[model samples]
Target chain A: MADVGDLVGRARDGEPRAVARLISLVEDAHPRLREVAAALTPYTGNAQVVGLTGPPGVGKSTSTSMLLTALRAEGRRVGVLAIDPSSPFSGGALLGDRIRMGEHATDPGVFIRSMATRGHLGGLAWATPQAVRVLDAAGFDVVLIETVGVGQSEVDVVRLADTTVVLLAPGMGDGIQAAKAGVLEIADVFVVNKADRDGADVTVRELEQLVSMTRREVRGRSWRQPVVRTVAAEGKGADAVVRALAGHRAWLEEHGELRRRRVARASGEVEAVAVQRLRAELGELRGGERLAQLAEAVVGRELDPYAAADALVAELRRG
Target chain B: MADVGDLVGRARDGEPRAVARLISLVEDAHPRLREVAAALTPYTGNAQVVGLTGPPGVGKSTSTSMLLTALRAEGRRVGVLAIDPSSPFSGGALLGDRIRMGEHATDPGVFIRSMATRGHLGGLAWATPQAVRVLDAAGFDVVLIETVGVGQSEVDVVRLADTTVVLLAPGMGDGIQAAKAGVLEIADVFVVNKADRDGADVTVRELEQLVSMTRREVRGRSWRQPVVRTVAAEGKGADAVVRALAGHRAWLEEHGELRRRRVARASGEVEAVAVQRLRAELGELRGGERLAQLAEAVVGRELDPYAAADALVAELRRG
Candidate 1:
């Protein structure tokens, strides 16, 4: 209902409603999304994007709240994007999760949005990057993307960040389970939350061993990931996690990997959008009768999938 | 490598090596894939596709092995595609899991393959369907697709099946976790494995309640998903599962849902291949310099992603 330029201007001026409106446009893939993107592009690429992710019951929300307070204490504006890739019916549950951050709900310096991947064609692949851009253009000092689970989609989401912090807790599972979840390589920083609980040291040690066993280099530069201990529920060790984040950010900047990561993220975004557009074109060509016929032929064993795909692509090109 | 026609011919004769080679081609997306598809298409559309999926430690492997035994007992050839969406480093662990099904390793009537979503661009989206087609064309009467974990990718994999079975065991959370994993809607049948355990009844009742609460109709026909109790480790209740599968298949055929489901599957397969081809084209266009330039502009805040996508699509059209 509002003009794109006016919405962008108000978002940059730190109006929560305007920022929410811009993100809704991105989420819904509104027809004016191009206009919104163009209007927001000039003020983008300033926010430091950080990703925090782990398994369920690992206190991700509490840790996010802790980080928000820590960053705000330093006089910085922070935006939180909580992504739930679960079922659409879990919205009520996610609302409960979001209420855990009630202390920061009224803070003028904080902007938080929860995105669900329900009914999305690509399942957060394309929408997330654009949502991050909206937050970045809004002039937030740091944008934290928090995902609910450690599935493939979550990994892809965290990969969009300048710094990715993987949270773990005692009694969740061992390091082998964590590695099997494929979190070892994506973590720029590791937080062993619930540190005061039993087996906290064991978790830290196991993670340290796993990290050492699978040492990785970014852009041919070795930046050994550090493991920090925290009890996020009580807000203990938040500063240490913050320090670890700052260290990773500095390392990334020193290695000139930040721009490279951003470019890579942008490249993925462009590819997703292009492929999505191609799919849409294929779905729309001849009102999908061509595709339906090709599928029927394939099902009838008169044609192979590759041949069917070729025919569909040809139709798309002609269209 | 053997010629595609020769390999396909051997595979149709039930040569295990030939079957393995053909699947490798599909897995690696080899250049001769189109030839393989053409050679195998005529023999497809004959195999029954059943997808078995659940949370980890839900006895999926055991149930799959049990079903293999049951199907083989009925003189029907069975093919198993156990998809592991876990870490690539967990290959050794997966090998151990695969060895659990070693009883039929030497059976000429059974073909088994374990597919890991490692280093794949689409993460088993395109590969699994082709792999299933290979087994289908190779004279396998039934193809069972078993996926580990209940993530979004697993759900997508199971959607390719004609009958989807969601397995659960006692103490593996409750109905809510299963619902949140988005498996309830995809399941045509639910298997409560390890039914001898203490909480098995409760799990079954919870699942039944959840299924009733979320009752869905297929093409205007209401088919209530049935919950079967099974102690798969001891090979009990597998015959019941087979019966349930048969009942569902018969229902599908009677309602013409079988052809509709197959056509839908083929359509998805076509769409995935079309999208993948477009992505490959985009990656190869102008040696990717054009894409890199677009990404740099987007990252530098000079162009929005939609505009970047538009420019890339323009280049693709010209090409």
Candidate 2:
């Protein structure tokens, strides 16, 4: 097997196969993939990652495909990481959403890949941001990350994106569900996909009410998020969506929001990477023995879990 | 107005008022309360923290009340922390599930306290295990933690408990939802609560099938997770639930699982405490001018969040 460094080098040389292989290595949880990804981080600041999230059947894939097509037409290279929620029972079965974007897959200008949640607690597939890094370092102008609609954790995607577009379906619910899930605050742009559906206007009105209420709560924020309606399948509102995104890009540039977002993204990436390292190093040294002993003790009830965890950490630190 | 140390002292001296005050202090997120609780951990090993988690309205509160009644009847003192999901609109709301357990509140032998999740990501209220530690140190024979049921992240409760009872309601969409949520694996004992409802037997059969399938997939030495049917409102099958818990306890004891459990609990608690300390320290230091500038940079998009976090941590270490 080629070492991670070699794969990363090939990826930096703009080899798609090398980039794909590197991502697979990281996704498979190879021990040295982190170092390779970290080495490439300095070269990764150029690509703007846009996260597209929404409920299933809300045309997130279609919207993404349209956006990819538009970006390609504009002579910019694009990469799509379509995140699918894994089937809990048969972990092997993936809800392959890329099939919907089949038209773009064959385009040399657009690179699309599907990622399963792999049963991780937080929504974005664990390997997602790393894959984005690979694409970014390989000089993609834009990388789009589409998440499977698992409510709150979906908010996590915002940490990984320059801009987040929350796709909404008309006639879904009273918008209370979205509010309850904390989706309203995280969305940079709200897209009412499937605009041809009934209640699109109502949905937009409700969303506007939500935005107004948010403004009332937050106050003094000049950038009021715009809600755009689009029939993604017919591609009627694709330009508006693209325009709204471009407007956001301009706003970020005008207000120095891009630099701030890059900092936030970099800080989040470092923290995540650090935490993963800490957990792995600590786990390797003591996790197996401590877990076995702790599981047995928990089963026996002689000591409580809190105490066991304390002992494990203490031991790890002592070592 | 009494300090946490004083309250801990009073509670240790068998004063219920002091114990209640100590619990309140912990719940309020007072920094001193953690120190007081840690001082009391050595005296808390005797109480068994039992975690109850399941889907919303699965009668977890009712089951908890019934189990409290049973334990009280056996002359065991019990502490109940009923965690409710907080309303996103209001940060403060009534922790009012006590109405369901009204019969036990004034029983003297049963101490029932309602807790709100308070925007914590984990299902159990963040203050839950701390409160459990307070109860344990106060001489309660058992501490019961009833989580706000969102299904995911309830696994955090496993780290806080000696035994985990997963409650399931009849006709909850064919048990697929339960399996999908990954609740079935963490359960030490499965209680088909609300057995009086129709399709109870079918739910039990379905659960059995799912559990069996999981066992086959993992294929190792596994304990047969016993399922008990309960009509908690009527107090039927409450004895069976207790017996099942007791049986698991015995199994753990015979196989030396108790010691292992104790270690695990201790280790988990220690890690949580360390993380809490890190967060507190970081929050304090981030109030400085340099960190403020860094935050501005992050907000401006010049620095990524990952790098900002890294710098913040580095600055803290320097201090």
Candidate 3:
């Protein structure tokens, strides 16, 4: 472990390697995380974190690359933290070139990092929020965190971004099934990607209605959610998607939501880490006599899981 | 707050209202869950819990309906837990009046239950496994737990079943996307539903290759993964799915994997409940001076979340 001061300084100086190292430290749960976070705090919160999530076979990666091009054209330094299933199959095929991700291979303004889930209960683990913090502090103007599927974990993933873009492809039979999947609640911007496909217009119309209905269902929201169309294979409609994101950002700031969202995001990250540590503490007790007895009691139905959990928490606290 | 004994007795008599009441008790986190579990324990371990899960719009409900017919024809009492995204559109359309689900509402041999995610991080949640206990103890011969998609939560959903079936439709390009989505690891049986559609053979071939590859990758599996094709809408190949599930169950029993899987499932349910209770305890601490101070410390980076979490857990213990 190098000096935190040097690493922070290098990261702030826009060194991709240094930025990557810092993110690694966070993901690896470095013992000095407190110091690292404290040191990086001054350099944080500038990046507009955007989350791109949808079902598989949707043009999530394609739309992402297209958005990357548009954002870069506008001269914004971008960072991407792709959650699992952003594999070479999805992104690399659309991204076309994965020679090397962060340095020496791609555009200088663009930085790409792929995250693989290590069988974590939530797809976005404790590491993702921390890693996002690293990218934020490293001065990425707009950081993109892309994940597949609109499941409960996607809701958590929304915590990593200020604006979340839900991508949908046309002719999936069930129009806007993304909303049905509970993603409508968390999405800020919806992208009907692969707009060149058949039934694109119908999909767009359905999304318009779904977005409005959901927006009304969720009361007191000052910002209206917008649906944008994209055909990322040829990069058409990519600029509109970027514009929509920026518009939402502006709306967030105008309504004093940006700071509030950041606070919520930070608290969420804090709570996630807290839960992770407690789980770790529990795992640490697995081989011990206490957990075994407690598990036995639970499995035997002599004690319900909640009651046994209370006893286990009490025992862990004693330690 | 009624007598736990009375509730259990009524639930055991196959009363729909009693069954629904028992499930509600679990979902609402009833304080009497301990006694309820103890009462139900004697009747469990008899039901064959098969999990059917896959992407949305894969005809899960249609397949489930067909399975109910086949299982009922075999004189088996079946329970279905459709875990979310089982839209009324599918169940009611293909099912033709989802009034009470599956073969003329008054059928006693089939019980259909749908579990919705109530903002739980994982789609399955604590209520699900406990509800499964309620159903199992109610003497359902086969409990089919169906969930949608391959999110992290779906992985958790797999723990609730002895055999997990992965359903995929053909022409959803990249024949093995299900494998890529982390479904392969949790799948024991693969069903390429909508087999009458074009490219069905291609999808089956791809899944066959994927199953073998994954089997080898996983290592030490005594039973082989099988791919079954079905056009669930017309009830085509429904018996084969039922047979495949039975075969998997038989293999599990012969290899002594069934008992192991049950133990694993019970332990997993225990762990999830414990974690949920701990989280609830933590949530209860919010707005208190201690939690506020700790959250402030973490957000301010004065203390890492791990240390703050330790203090919070210790405080909970003291209380």
State interface RMSD in Å for all models.
3.2, 6.3, 5.1
lDDT of 3 at B116: 60
What is the per-residue lDDT of model 2 for residues B1-319, given as tens digits with 9 covering 90 to 100?
7765677788877677888888777667664654675567557668877888775567777788789888888999888876654433221222445775778756767777776554443224246766787898888888888764442333465446778888888876637666765667677788998898999988899888888877522224466778889999899998998898888777666766666666565555444554444444455674645555665664444554446556766655565
By the DockQ metric, which is better: model 1 or model 2? 1
By how many angstroms RMSD does model 1 differ from the true structure?
2.8
Best by lDDT: 1
Q: Over the stretch B219-319, how does candidate 1's per-residue lDDT look in tens digits?
A: 78878899999998889998999999999999999899999999989988888888889889988889868888999999887888889999999889888
DockQ-based ranking, best first?
1, 3, 2
Residue range A193-258, candidate 2, lDDT tens digits = 888988899889888888877752223435667899988788778788788888888877777778
Ranking by TM-score: 1, 3, 2
User: Candidate order by lDDT, highest to lowest?
Assistant: 1, 3, 2
For model 1, fnat equals 0.53
Provide the overall lDDT of each model, using Cα atoms, as 2-decimal numbers.
0.85, 0.67, 0.72
Measured on C-alpha atoms, candidate 3 has an lDDT of 0.72
TM-score of 1: 0.92
For residues A34-123, write the lDDT of model 1, one tens digit per residue: 888889888888889999888777889999999999999999899999987654223345667789899999998999999877667766
